[model samples]
Target: MANGWAPDGAVQDQIDDTVKDAVLRARGMMPSGDGSDECDDCGEDIPAARRAALPGTRRCVACQAKRDATLRSVGINRRGSKDSQLR
Candidate 1:
């Protein structure tokens, strides 16, 4: 299975790298430390129940949902090659 210009195992290497990047990104997105009393994004009070339940939340429900929506709209392109850029 010789790729025209890629060396052997290059495809698998790309896949592995993509998976590793995704894992690192997911870990970075994890909440950390004690939950803040106020929303970090909107300056609104975070509910006691939300803080208690999530333990490390920094945003109110509305702000958190908005942040999540923004994140969801931004897709990560692991394969940042020129071909991928063209597409």
Candidate 2:
């Protein structure tokens, strides 16, 4: 039931790849170990609440927010479609 030239399961494969990519991206964004008591970026004390909530956090709230903003600004599209590449 694939459209055009795609073979059967092609669409499903694409969907699976997209989902895998998203999962990997999310995992990469998460901290790995116990969160530090101090911000890695600014040397400020990382709040206990934040450390408790995000176990691997390395930055203070403000630094984390800034880093998030910066990351958001650099948009990543995992679709890898020809149309997307053209743009």
TM-score of each: 0.61, 0.72
| Tens-digit lDDT string for candidate 1 (1-87) | 647887898878878887887888878887898779998888989999988888899989998788877886344575577987998
Q: After superposition, which runs of candidate 2 have C-alpha atoms over 4 Å from their true positions?
A: 72-82
| 1-87: candidate 2 lDDT, tens digit per residue | 987787888878878877787788888888987668889999999888888888988999899888888875334455567987999
Clashing pairs in 1: none
Compared with the true structure, the alpha-carbon lDDT of candidate 2 equals 0.81
Q: Pick the candidate with the highest TM-score.
A: 2
| Residue 65 C-alpha lDDT in model 2 | 86
